[model samples]
Target: MITVSNLTKRYGSVHALGPVDLEIPRGGVTALIGPNGAGKSTMLTIIGRLLSGDSGRVEVGDLDVVTADSRELAKKLAILRQENHFVARLTVRQLVGLGRFPHSRGRMRPDDVEAVDLALEFLDLTPLQDRFLDELSGGQRQRAYVAMVLAQQTDYVLLDEPLNNLDMRHAVTMMRQLRRAADELGRTVVVVVHDVNFAAAYADLVVAMVDGRIAHVGPAREVITPYVLTEVFGTPVDVIEHRDRPVAVYYH
Candidate 1:
């Protein structure tokens, strides 16, 4: 389980996050949904140890995120941020190999190779593994980056807006893959999604944030209602049953 206590962040005088407490359980997919500037990214980055909280504590399982060793934390959690900038020219395979650095210490062994191959296969990039990252399309590169994170083989995965650059088909594929990871591999999956319908469809739990705080956290059926969606987004949303699942429709 991930325990966050009184976590807060600030920029100058602006309060970005904080005084927030949450408990994310293990072995299921949880989706964080909210409006822009709702601090969804801030919270995910802090939990993944990509960003520091001004005042708070984060514990992934038994490891203290604020004080744990970098390698140890990497072994326990793998994260994919929204922005990725690769300076050096590297092939897809080389980039995925970096995920094994914590385990292999820069020298990849047979198991590391197998992990990379499996991740590539999982993301349907095995045939393109030899291709340079710059040579791939935007969506392909995004998938490659996610594949790198998955190759880490950690128990906890946090993804911030991973659906960016993905088409509808690939987006669904990604969510299904995440669901499978949680159900089959017993991994904890937390994702930030802009589409409420996707969250309602795949997530076992839905965490709704607004104005830098959690507005609601519950099962998809509970949080995806019209009342909650209208409140969280500050807009009118109609909930309709589609194939036995609640789907939020905002477009008139």
Candidate 2:
């Protein structure tokens, strides 16, 4: 399990996040959802050890995030930020191969090559593996990036807004791919999503945050109600059941 205890962060006088505690069980997909500045990204970054908490402890499995060795942590968890920029132009295969660096240390053995190939195939990027990143459409590029993280072969994967700029079809496809990753690959995926409906449909657990604290955490059916969503987002919301799953409808 990923555990957070009394975590807090600050910037000058502004309290950005915390004194919050959360537990994310291993396996399945857990989504962090909330309004802007609700601290979803802040908490995720802290758990990934990309950002430090002012006080408190975070543990992924038995490894202490703050005190664990960098290489060891990388093997246990992989995180993709909102914006990824590569200075040197890289092929899709090359970007995915980078995930093997933690294990290969810049040397590509047969096993590492096999792993990269599997990730490429898993994301349906094998056909475009030789294409440069800039040559692909936005959705395809996003898939390549995700394939890179999957190639890392970690038990835990954290993504910040993987659906950021995609069209409706691409967004649905991305969510479906993530769902497949959790079900087929046995990965524990944690994502920060803006759309509550997406979280309801794809996430096994929905963690809703308000201000800098978590407002609710539970299965999608329990947390995606009009009362809870309206409270967390400060907007009127109506939830309707579609194909046995609750979907939030906020646009009137």
| lDDT against the true structure, each candidate | 0.92, 0.95
Estimate the TM-score of every prediction: 0.97, 0.99
Candidate no. 1 TM-score:
0.97
Candidate 2 matches the true fold with a TM-score of: 0.99
The residue-by-residue lDDT of candidate 1 on 1-252, one tens digit each, is 999999999978998887789999988999999999999999999999988999989999899998999899999999999789958999999999998988999999999999999889988999999999999988889888888888899999999999987899889988888888788768899999999999999999999999889999999999999999999999999999999899999997
Which one is best on lDDT? 2
Off by over 4 Å in 2: none
Residue 32 Cα positional deviation in candidate 1, in Å, after optimal superposition? 0.5
Model 1: lowest-lDDT 10 consecutive positions? 177-186
Tens digit per residue, CA lDDT, model 2, 1-252: 899999999978999898899999999999999999999999999999999999999999899999999899899899999899867799999999999999999999999999999999999999999999999999999999999999999999999999999999999999999999999999999999998889999999999998889899999999999999999999999999999999999997
lDDT of 1 at 148: 88
